[model samples]
Structures are given as structure tokens and as C-alpha cells.
Target: MTLTNEFFQQLESLFPKAADSPWYVYAALVFQANDRMELISSTWRYVQSTTSKAEDQIVKARKMREALLKASVLVGFPKGINACTTLRKALLADSPEIESELDKDSSLRQHLSRSEKDARGMDFFSKIYAQHTDRVLQNMSVASGGDLSEFAINAVYGDLMAEESRLNAKETGLLEFLACYATGGSVWAQAKGHMYGSHNLGNGKAEIQGAVKICDTIEETLDIKVNRAPAENWSWLAKAEKW
Candidate 1:
């Protein structure tokens, strides 16, 4: 879909300007977008299927699980503690396939089982950002209306900012920033607030320049400009929190 004026205005309400991220961040944006879509899509299905009270809900839940699990591999997002205890527990409670697979993933967790250890192990951000990264996650969770919780936030970002990651925080933040921008909805604004507020992005004008470049990259990659027919407008992001 084209990025509409309404969307941009809503985004600027929170972010003020586009950010200039590193090259790897640009690349990560594409894959991250796909991962985020996988998350959004699967979440909807899980919600719909679970509340249906139909026998076939399991079938649908199973399919959604497949997609979400795959997305996790690509984006390195471990299902958060809340997701695990709530939806994952219910969905996998009786399903052998889901249980067996979730057991092996190592990313999904039923509680904040590894956060402190993960935090201690991390060496990704410099001393300052690393120390304060969890605070950033708290801010993001609050801005996302709790859709992105601390556990879920840590599962995904912990790896992204890990000491040995191929992608640096600057790169991670840029792609992350663009991924939020691509959402083109209220979530986009929230995403922008969290990302722009984070420390990984370039300072001042670099971010603005990066925003322009990110938009251009989106155009080139999608082979469609946000200025074109505006394609079917859709912006409501799944409340990808509980499930």
C-alpha cells in the first residue's frame, strides 16, 4: 500500500522525522517487516480461532503456529512469557504437534526464565545503551499499549543487540525503525516513538536523511511508490500482546 498523507502525518506526530540508519539496518528492515507481518497475521488467526469454540480452531491455530514459529526463526523473536503462558499454553495444551515443536524451539518461554541471565550475557550495546536497553523496552511496551511486553521485547531484542550479533544496534534500530514505519497505522506512530527514542539511531539530521532513504528503499523494493493509487488502505495493527 502507498504511504498516505494521513499515515505520514500520524507517524510524524510521534517521530517528527525519519531516521538515518546504517546499511545493514536497511537490509534488516525488509526481513524484519516480513517477520512482523508473520507475527501480525498469525496473531489474528490465533485470536479468531481460539475464541471460536469450534473444533476446527485447533486446525487453524496449528497453521498460525507454523507461520509464527517460522517468523521467529527469521526474526529471532522468541515468543514472550505472556504469550507462552496464555495462548501458547492453550494452543499447545492438547496438540501433540504444537507441544513437540515448541519444546524444541528454545526461544519460547512460559516465564521470564532467562532474562536476567540473558541481560548479563549480553555485550551488544556499549556500556551505556546496554545498561539502559531494558528501559527502552519498557518504554516501547508502554507505547505499544502493552502489545509488546518486556518478555517478548527481550526475546526479540536481546538477540539483536547481543554481543556477537552480525547486526549492530545502529543497524538493528534503523531496520526496526523502518519496520515500524512500514506498518502505516497507529502502531506506526508508537513504533516510531519507541525506535526514535531508542539510542541506536544516528543523531539529528542523520535520522531525517535515513527516513528519506528508507522510504526510497521501500519504493524500490516494492516497485510501487507510496504516492501511487494508495492501494487498499489498512493500518490497524493486531494487538499482538496477549497472543
Candidate 2:
């Protein structure tokens, strides 16, 4: 279904301070509902018209191109290669000297003026990446997992193969789910379940390797909780009561 006014209204209410802001969610909604070619063309025209008004054409163009690339990815385009290449060509055409002049531009700063928003976006993106990558790895494992014995009881009970063809993350909502699943607990049982659900660990041989790699990544980069319970600061709140 097309994104109704209700959706935008709900989002606006949920994020009142971000009303009409140039955020991914807003752009994603448009991408989900609109035609990609028209959207990209319109966005290019808008950037051309508005960059002068924004007082820094080069910086504004870069941001618009970045947004276009993100939206393209959400709409099932190959963002890492094709969509990015297209966007970059568009940017260079619009501002042929953007790369050379970018360093000297005073008005076109890093847009850290909204550090809070930037931080929030980065945190969200990082968590999304961690979870989605984990899922892709897991699904590959299960589909490739050779023996049924490799999978734990839960995977068998849940029938993980039902999602055989559609395992990759195509939408933001799916990414959010993967992130939530990886948020806590480090016991062998939990790890097995996580690994099993991915479909990659279905084969006994791949299961162990998958688990190890996931664990290593989580330990190094993810703020994972192997032993801690997932909560909104129960420990710190308890400590604060002492003060």
C-alpha cells in the first residue's frame, strides 16, 4: 500500500522535532511508494534549484547525492556499485569542481551543527549493519548447513527453511529486527539459536565456523551482551538510587 497521510502523521508525532527534516525514514517512505526514475530526476532538479539558495552548492549537492544513493539502495538497487556510480556521475555533472573546491569551502562544513541528529543516525546505521550482516551470514549457513543434527531444536521447531529465497535484508524494518535479536546474551545455547536461525549453521561443519566468526565480530565491534540482560539501564538506575 502507498504510504498514507496517517503514516507520515504518526512519524511526525513520534518525532515532532524532526518534522519535515531530510532524514532517511522520510526519503525511504517516498522511495517505497514512488517511481525510482521520477524520484531521482525530481531530486536532481530540486537540488539544482535549491543549492544556490542553500548558499553552498557543492556541499548541498553532495548531501542530496548521498540521500539519493541511500534511497536507491532501499528501493532494491545495487547501492554499493550501480546506484553510487550513477549518483556520483550526476553530482560531478552538476558541480564539475566540487571535489577540488570542497576543501576550501567555509560555509559547507560537515553539517555537525546537528551533532545530536548525526549521532542518532550513525548509531542507528551501525546497529542495522551489524544485525543485517549477521542475518545474511546466518541464512547462508543454514541453507548450506549439511546435516539436520547441526541445527538446534528451536530451528527445527520454527522451520527456518520457510524463508529460503528471501533471507537478505531489503527493508529497514527487517534490519531493525536483526539488530534487536543480536542485542543480548552470550551463552552457548543463545549463540546456537542465533546461529541456527540464520540457516547458515544447518550444516554441522559450517555451524561452528559461523558461530565463531559472529562471536569474534560481536566481541570486537558490537556492544554485545554475552552475560548481561538487555534493559534500559537497570544497573545504572539501581546504582543511582544509592545517591
Candidate 3:
């Protein structure tokens, strides 16, 4: 499956009512992570037309750019770099003025030291993982002899996801889920963790379900088979609603 205009319309229908939500960005990232470079421009055009308005086109572009940057860690830098470059091309063609609005030094994390990134990352990580943060970090430490956990906290969480200049915590949390989902079935465990993180960040059940439905739709449309977890594994989400 190729991304057709019909698929684009279907994807657009799945988006939340809020125009500024990162879910729009996720649509483009999905194709990027899947190595569908051919579809990226069309996807960007769809996203750009729908989300970018005259008043806030620059804001929307920055948010989309930031989401792509944050998702790079999960999907790989090569794809991320290509996606960003393609998106810039699309933006330039469609709205040259908005393209000019972007900052030369877009990353706020570049100015910070390692310790600052760690502190910021830990703070964001604590918010998402909540009570399970310690256990999760401990497991990562044990699994990788501490290197993996430290890198995850300091680099991924602190340096990337924690950056709120454009995408906020809630948006980044949802982006995590989308990024993992786009990578396919191999990382469902990580995807589920981010789904829970979305919940922890105050995403309602309906909203999370909408995101999942979008992923399911994309997989089906693309004729891609992902080994998604069984329904029983998601029962906790329903249970958590009561708690």
C-alpha cells in the first residue's frame, strides 16, 4: 500500500478536533519512520493544508519540526533527517514566508550541559513514568549494565522529549506512542509504555483510542501486518479509568 488521496482523507478524519495537536505531525512521521519517502511530500501537503493557517502557520510548522526531531531517537536519525529535509522543501514550496519563521538554532537543548539535560530529562521522565519510574529505570540498568538507562534518561528523555519550547510534555508523550507504533510490531512493548505515558500525561481514554484507531487504519491501508499485543493486554487502560 501506497498512500493515496483516499488514505490521506481517511487519516485526516482520524485527527482530533484541535488543530494544534501533534497527531497531525504524527501522520507525517508515520510515513517517515516506515521508509515511505515517496509519501512524505503528499503527507506533508495534507498536514500543511489542514494544520497550517495564516495566523499560526509558523507555530504549526515549528511544532511539526519539533515532533520530527523528538521522534528521531526512536525511528533513527537517518529517516528523521530525510523527513525534516523533505518537510522543509514542502514548506518552502507552499509557504516560503512561514519557512522563514523557523529558528536557525531550533534546538534549545544544545545550549545546556549534560547535567542540565539529565535534570530536565529526569523531571520529564518522572512525570510520565510516575510511580513506576524507579522500577523501569532499574530494569533498564540491569538489562544494559546501567549504560542504556543513563542514556535513555539523559539523552532521549532529557535532551529531546523534555524540550517544551514547541511540543509540550503531553504532546511529546503522545508522539512517543505514535513513533513506536510507526516502527511496527517489534517495539509494541515500548509503544504500550508510551501509550500509558500518554494517559499519565492526562490524555483521556477516547483520545488515546482515537490515536490507536489511526494507527490501525494506517496499518490496514498499507497492507502491513504488525504483531500487535492481544486485547487482554490493554485491559489495564480500562481499569485505570476507574482508579
Residue 216 displacement (Å), model 1: 2.9
TM-score against truth, every candidate: 0.38, 0.31, 0.87
Question: What is every candidate's alpha-carbon RMSD to the true fold?
Answer: 14.9, 18.1, 2.6
Ranking by lDDT: 3, 1, 2
Give the Å error, residue 155, model 1. Answer: 0.9
Off by over 4 Å in 2: 1-20, 23-35, 51-56, 68-74, 77-82, 89-94, 99-140, 144-243
Candidate 3 colliding pairs, count: 1
What is candidate 1's lDDT per residue for 1-243, written digit by digit as tens?
Answer: 333344333323333333321332232233244432332333333344334454334444443343333223233454422232344655454455545554565433343446643563244332325456577557757988865644444555443333222333444444444554544444555454435433344434445344445555544644633331233322222221111
Can you write out model 2's per-residue Cα lDDT over 1-243, one digit (the tens) per residue? 233444333333332232222322333223322333333333444445534543355545554444433334324445324444544565556655664554354422234334433344334333333445445435546776834322311232112211112221222222222222333343333333333333332222232232233333333432333444455422322321222
Model 1: runs farther than 4 Å from truth?
1-28, 31-148, 160-164, 198-204, 220-243
Q: Report how far residue 229 has shifted in candidate 2, in Å.
A: 36
- Indicate the worst ten consecutive residues by lDDT in candidate 1: 234-243
Per-residue error for 61 in candidate 3, Å, reads 1.3
